[model samples]
Target: MRLWAASVAICMAQAAHACETALLLTIDVSNSIDVAEYRLQVDGLADALLDAEITDVIVQGQSALAVVQWSGVDRQELSIPWTQLRSRTDVQTFAAQARAMPRAFVLSDTAPAEALDFALRQFADAPACDRRVIDVSGDGTPNSGSDPRPMVRAAERAGVTVNGIAIESMGLAITNFYRREIITRDGFVITARQHRDYPRAIREKLLRELSRILG
Candidate 1:
């Protein structure tokens, strides 16, 4: 009887920790991203998390989040560890942490395939959630490492969705590349007119991801 009671408690604990979504945000910080552009990406993401609608969804759904900075084949860092947004305070704390984080890599080449591979490993450590998503934000296509399409397929096989946010500083070329090679079939892409517009794009993307609204 004691063993059965302990088993029930363990299951209850697991249920309580489950979240609506586990989102892994992978940002590019390759050589092309200047210091100012890097700041924009980091600060923009911080501000997006503070958006009213986004905050509300996060708090209500208790979504898990992590941020990764990726560049060349071996340059990928988990800037923000797995955190659960279960309340207003939790959201605020995450925003503050994001804003204060230092750039993980610079002077590195673009490697989207390696980035995706790294992000997939991150999911293994995340809290259990109903949906798992990888949000890749970058301004350029891969110029180094393996092809990203296979990684996208691997994500699909893992039942993980891969979304893209293309920073269109160099025009729609990068956006087109993302649509063709990065995002999964069930996922979509958001285009930021430039680095400065990342905050708005990220907010909208978060809304759609958390709410499951394709539009």
Candidate 2:
């Protein structure tokens, strides 16, 4: 009797998670970013949602989203717990929380691979998500962790699309590495070519990934 009850509970849990479209937003803040630029990225969180094209896709009670911040091999933090984006109110609240977030992890090195690993681990026990993806934004190549390519494959094997947003800084080499390394369905990287253009980059990038996914 107890085994049957447990099976029913598992099935219901799976049903709930099946309705989730979990997106992990990974923000880069390692040696590449200064204080001002960090604020720019954080401030743009609201724009990612309230922007016209983005709002067109937010079906109430359908999408569940979360955020993960990564810098060094050991530096990874969860900015917002997973929540259902059911209304405009939810987006506003998430933006406020992210903007007001105090840095919980230190910036030591750029471990893009570790970021990918952390994101995968976060989904381990969660309900099964339909469109589970990791959006990794960065300015340069991996300097201090496992190679990102292998982790990219791991993500693909797990059915998580790994999309990228490469910052086109004056000194970096990974201009559009996302295009070369990531290969999930509809997975592509957008380049801003300048940190000053982060807002436009974030808005355009999110619209491409998070909008009309159902249509």
* Highest-TM-score candidate: 1
Worst 10 residues of 1 by lDDT: 206-215
TM-score of each: 0.92, 0.83
Report how far residue 25 has shifted in candidate 2, in Å.
0.2
| Per-residue alpha-carbon lDDT of candidate 2 for residues 25-134, written as tens digits (9 for 90 to 100) | 88888877888877877787667777755755554325666788789999999888776676777777777887887765655798888888898888864545567778
Collision pairs in model 1: none
- For residues 1-215, what per-residue lDDT tens digits would candidate 1 score against the true structure? 99999999999887766699999999899999999998898888889899888999998788999999999999999999999988989999999999999998878999999999999999989998999999999999788999999999999999999998999976699889999999998999999999889988988899999997642
Q: Which candidate is the best by lDDT?
A: 1
Candidate 2: deviation at residue 182, Å? 5.0
Each model's backbone clash number:
0, 0
Off by over 4 Å in 2: 1-20, 125-127, 182-186, 212-215
TM-score quality measure for candidate 1: 0.92
